[model samples]
Target: MTPDAILALYEWVIGACFRCGDANLFVTPIDAVVTPRGERYPLAACGGCVLDMEEERRRFAERKGEKYHPGRLGRPPA
Candidate 1:
């Protein structure tokens, strides 16, 4: 590939987070979002974003009278 194309690919990967678009944040592959028009897009999210999403899930579970078990999404030691 050309130098410009390579650089563009690098930049795209660096900003691959579907939610925050923060290159510095570590990411995990999450589920995809399906639009009403039947388009599906994959997602990856940072730790903070995952925590926020978990919190929302917890709230919804409580509202529905269900138990919420948190997952192990933290980064392990190198």
Candidate 2:
């Protein structure tokens, strides 16, 4: 799903962030996912949510302390 991030969608800049469910002032980075059947649904994720996700990911990585790294494309490096 790729969201077409826009500051204003039809002159509206307030919505719920998919991650935190807060009043979003910046209608940016909205995730727009398209279903296989050609249906589109906007997600709830603001910039703050993206940061939060990144932080959570970093913490998770720290916990695992992985040494092996996968290929850039997730496949084994040739």
- Taking every candidate in turn, the Cα RMSD to the unseen true structure, in Å, is 12.9, 9.8
Worst 10 residues of 1 by lDDT: 6-15
List candidate 1 segments past 4 Å from native. 1-15, 33-41, 72-78
- Superposition TM-score, candidate 1 onto the true structure: 0.56
* lDDT scores of the candidates, listed in order: 0.58, 0.48
Candidate 1 clashes between residue pairs 3 or more apart in a chain or in different chains: none
Displacement of residue 54 (Cα, Å) in model 2 is 1.6
* Model 2 lDDT-worst window of ten: 1-10
User: What is the lDDT for 12 in model 1?
Assistant: 26
Model 2 alpha-carbon miss at residue 58, Å: 0.5
For model 2, how does the per-residue alpha-carbon lDDT over 1-78 read when each residue is reduced to its tens digit? 122232122223567776677874653444577899999877655555554554565566678894422111112334
